[model samples]
Target: MTASLPVAPDARQKPVIAVVGPTGTGKSDLAIALAQRLGGECINADSMQFYRGMDIGTAKLAEDEMGGVPHHLLDILDVTDEASVAVFQRQARELFDEVRARGNYPILVGGSGLYVRAALDHLEFPDTDPAVRARLEAELQERGRGVLHARLAELDPASAQRVNDDRRLVRALEVIEVTGRPFSSFMPVRQYVQPAIQIGLNGPRELLHERLHQRVVKMAEVGLLNEVAELETRGLRQGKTASRAIGYREFLKVLDSQRGVLQEEYSVADAITDTVVATRQFARRQITWFSADERVRWIDFTDPASLSHALRAVTDA
Candidate 1:
């Protein structure tokens, strides 16, 4: 299983291979293949996949799908635990060192853009003030994301431009308030923290859209509702990060309708439609994020030579 890949003659360390792309593009499958061929361990960089019992919706790899390769940093959080990129960066680096110590290449794989950057780039997170964060959260709830985002735009245009969600918007404002500096100051540089190689998978837009639609449909067919219902019992609704996940949030609305709480007739099919739209949008954002990085070597997901090209990239690194 341990096929040797070429390294620089004076290379001091093994290069961490990152398989990154939008969802449904077979990033996980490629990561597994690389790990199997290189005698490497796969590290989960997909933020949502950190949660336990989120399998069906997140398209988490099943045990058999792992192809007997050791995977780390998955299923390590509860439904109620808020995922932190800072914490993930620490954990991922630690796992990287451990995997390298074992004489195996560490492969980082996921579509979560910031988490991937935090793992491979020179990123520094600012400290958080609980009071400042709470105040921002309150303002977010009261004045809404648009207003808060405008405020961020006034204070830190760069950070505001990059932030797409309420959580990040709030965090950016909090960082500005806490440090008396622009949140963009903490943004990651393109420089890597260590030796690394990134392989990005992509394909035709129409094909990716169709794949996303089918994937969401498959999630529904395989009992994503049941999975969400189970997580709901375990405080999924109370978890700030977990509750906002694409499929989980949509399904929760369906659950609310079933309980006569929302007074709207939201069916599973409706949720599926919403999830498909949201997932496609998210995939687009992911593409925008990863494509900005020139360090990533692009490969067509539909190309039969993708795996071979990826292997060559690693060997020729």
Candidate 2:
């Protein structure tokens, strides 16, 4: 792997293209087609998609959608285990190396900007402190995740801007508390990686919102509620990272209602509606994150012709 990384000076490095965008942007279909045509294999970068038995909500790729192209790092972790960005970077880098060894282009595909960027840049985060984590978790239990957000806002406003009002903020505070440095300050810069193009999918905000609504509806019809129920059987609580996932958290309300845990009469339909709204907000954040990356070649997904042109640019590059 080391020998292959620095073989030539002027010649373009074998591209490790990344297909990154917000959810419901058709990234999976485009990635499969791109892999088929470009001699590429996909490396999943979505954090939630890493969990086993988490298909419907994560929009996991079906067997038929793969189109005979090999995929890596999907459904590899049990819900009981935590998959961190540092862990993802290590495993995904190995897969990237293996793909390059097989003489195939590697495509990192997902909406998880942190995972994608960390893997591409070969980031190595500082070791975590269990003591800090314990304290943070205790604070979360006593107060709430909003307490961690307030702490992050005080400690590192830049990192807080990237984090939503959930586990992301909690993780940011954890990193800060453990490392004694702001999370944003310790970010690994791009180094010792392949030279390649990046592409981000885009659509009109209104159209994207509509797509998200339709997506949540289709997911409900396809048994998203049942999927969450199965996870509940495994003791997936709201405090875990897997439970904080958009679809999982929303359905949890309905699951509690059925379990006689919550007093309110929350229906599955209500959960589905909440999931749609949360997913739209998530998609907006994803777009904002990708826009920060100046190297990304953005394409309007609402127009098929624009996608064709974007693909041409990718091939031409």
Candidate 3:
């Protein structure tokens, strides 16, 4: 049983609540508060936070921080496991329905824009061929991400512009090949599969940049290096997805330096800087993704009145 009083499935219809935006924008905090106010549970959408032993890097909140609200789909994978949006959509919807059936609000929270859409929208993913994917990945390594991105732009400019990661770029091209159409054709429409209220939390660009830098520094100061070190022993190096996560990847470079594997030593300072830059680029990508959807009610969540505004938005929706 949850700390909040449970409702019967037929008690009333409550829209699923989604709190989204860039990192360091307090979306998680807002989601928890909204869940408490609405007597709901949370479903995590941040892709990197799904691994069991990746607490520090992914910024997984402590149990005490959760404030007795039940959270689902966290720590459900190992460092070696790859996250599949198709599978996540299936599992997340199942858990979301269960929460609604129990008469509690199912709050969706994360910085991963696509994952959130996949959970709440009618988004479909195409199947992949290992042989085709392997060839694309090899070309990505040899020709660099820019070459693949340029090829994609020529074939599917809409999808090409939205991609910021090499893996995603490769995947988009693969999808175009497999489906014989532009990858953007498979994009989510501005409609929810379930009744839902989407709220985006953001702040001034300069402030968010500073906060992201501080967050990276804090992560480094608070054993982020050690955490990455531990995960390296757990096959993080071999995990295609987990190994490429922002903090984990940067710190792995530091690890190599510590072992004297590189001629020039990589410093903690270097890792922090790299992380900050990567995070800022990632935040820009996230904001762009959400901005494309007219349905999200954007709010400056750092302001004192945001709670009232959010309450009004959710209640009215």
RMSD of each: 5.1, 5.1, 5.0
C-alpha local distance difference test of each model: 0.92, 0.81, 0.88
> Across residues 126-208, which tens digit of lDDT does each residue of candidate 2 receive?
76777877777788889987777877889999998888756566677888767788888876676536666677888888888
Taking the candidates one at a time, how many backbone clashes does each contain?
Answer: 0, 0, 0
Which 10-residue window of candidate 3 scores lowest in summed lDDT?
1-10
Comparing 2 with 3 on TM-score, the higher-scoring candidate is 3
lDDT of 3: 0.88
Q: What TM-score would you give candidate 2 relative to the actual structure?
A: 0.80
In candidate 2, which residue ranges exceed 4 Å CA deviation? 1-12, 131-185, 190-192
Q: Rank the candidates by TM-score, best first.
A: 1, 3, 2
The candidate that achieves the highest TM-score relative to the unseen native structure: 1
Off by over 4 Å in 1: 1-12, 132-184
lDDT of 1 by residue, 249-292 (tens): 99999999999999769999999999999999999999999999
lDDT of 3 at 66: 96
